[model samples]
Target: MNFSLVREMMRKDLQEVRKNGYVFYSLLLLPIMLVVISVIDSFAIALSSSGKASMLLPTFSTILVFIPAIITSLIGSTSVILEKNNHSLEPLLATPITDSELFAGKALAPLSIGILLSWLAFTLYMAIMDVLTYGHLGYFLFPTELTLVQMFFLAPVTGMLGTFLTLLVSSKMKDVRAAQQVSALVVLPLLLLIFLPIIASGSDLLINLLAGVGFLIAALAIFFVSVKAFRRETILISWGK
Candidate 1:
């Protein structure tokens, strides 16, 4: 593993991703949208007499988990597909870099972007919740133990899962939209997990523990499998046609 080559590749991929205006715009807008939604929810909770605004925190955390995954999937798949269509990938592959180096470089940008943005969104969400509920609850009520675990532990894994699945699908499919559509399925189980409280019976602690363990295992498995299966030869062959 050549660290220099990996860094160079990551730099190049980041440049390419930055060139896409839509990706930049989407990244900019997503956090704002999340803040707006959360603010509105807080207001609604404030007006209601249920006095269970804190209970909604988990649901908000669950929703925040998806933001980075969706963003990374779009950017990751599009990055690979664009490189293929633009005839840039073959020339890059022709260089002296190894397949592992190339894959790591490609995966790093989207994975980092997703994780960073997810954490930022989570921070904003936490801030909003604390501000709105502090007046009502008489204390700062966010960054709970479970929320901390979810943000620091589960979110990165979910982002990596999205990045790996998107890159895998992109390498196999010529059509960007097709690759994205297929890669999107990787989050189906995660989406279902958001509804766990309603569909399954368990204490919050039990559910959070299960979800954290599950996502960590899945992320590690996907990362290894994706690295093993993503051959430079296969990607070139698929794109060449």
Candidate 2:
């Protein structure tokens, strides 16, 4: 793989992601609101019913854990379609960059942003959790082994799955909005499998681990398969249609 080419492509995409106001905001707002609302609600609950705040941790964390995947899908799904609409894609496609390089480049920006935002949000959430739980547990209990795995491994894998699926979906789409809308579906499977808490016990731990493994495998397989399956001509034809 041409690392330079991949980096160049990633750089260009990142710049474009920032330049487009609506797209940038669309990518940024949901996760921020999600984190902010959850933290504020939990803080409010802790102020009132200290015992109940702990109960909300599992479900809230489960949702927060997947924010990266959500952000990835939203950004990834629209990445290509937006460029195509702007007539910027053809020039990029005509370059000497190989499909694998281009694919990696396209995937990097959304993947990086998704994971980075998730970590930041997780940090805020941890602080909130520590404060809320301190009165009861007397110490910070967040970022446990399970949380670490979810953030570092499971989340990225899930985001990759969404990225690859959305790229494939976007290939046939001329409309960025429609592509983004479809990309939303990719998060559902991750959500169903990663609910490791608030299920009456830790029984879901096994399920979440199995699901994470499955996502990692699927993301890897799809990335390689999609690179081979990617057809520049098909994309051109689809845009014309």
Candidate 3:
């Protein structure tokens, strides 16, 4: 493994991510809204006459995973698409790096950002729990250990897959808008998963887990296909006008 290449790629990728204010802001909004809603819900439950407070827990848990996917897709795919469409990908491939290395390097941005956001979200959740529970957070959310661990592991995988899937479309697309519109379709199923059960008065963890696994498998398939299709010759010919 080329550690230097990986490090350089990661640094440059982060720099590129920083330039995309919409992506950062979108990612930031998730945590901000979550924290705000949690606080408000905590207060509302404390004051309300109904016993419906506990119902909000599942919704909160779902957001921990969904936020990373949405934000990562927006930022990571845009960067890859811009480079490929502008004909810069040809020069990148002109280097001595193998396709695998380049793919790994290009993948770093979404992976890092997604994992970072998940960890931060967990931290925020913990902090809020402590405050809302009056330091007895452990008593209220027992068995959160497994749930948090799952989110930590799953968030990055989801983000990486979403980004790679979008990159695949972007690589083949000449119009950026068309690429984005198509890639945005990736989240519709996830949205349906989150909401359909709530509307139907039931939810199943097993179904959600199976859906996520399917997404991971599909993501892996798309990534390898993109790598195969990303030759310098093809990119130089199909890039922007």
Taking all chains together, each candidate's TM-score versus the true structure is 0.85, 0.83, 0.75
Candidate scoring better on lDDT of 2 and 3? 2
Q: What is candidate 2's CA lDDT for residue 24?
A: 79
List residue ranges in candidate 2 displaced over 4 A: 40-59, 185-206
Task: Give the top-scoring candidate (TM-score).
Answer: 1
TM-score of 3: 0.75
Mind giving the per-residue lDDT tens digits that candidate 3 earns over 17-130? 677787667777776776567556655654472345444343455556655666655665566557766667767778776666666677777667776877677667656655
- Sort all candidates by TM-score, best to worst: 1, 2, 3
Q: lDDT of each prediction vs. the true structure? A: 0.71, 0.72, 0.62
| For every candidate, C-alpha RMSD to the true structure in Å | 2.8, 3.1, 3.8
Query: Candidate 1 residues 1-241, lDDT tens each?
Result: 9999999888887776678787677786876787678667656865584566666544556566666567777677767667777888889888999877887888888777777777888888888878877887898977887667667866777677677767766777767777767666655455455546632432265676677677678767877787887787787777536
Model 2 C-alpha lDDT versus the unseen true structure: 0.72
What is the lDDT, from 0 to 100, of the residue 29 in candidate 1?
84
Q: What's the number of clashes in each of the models?
A: 0, 0, 0
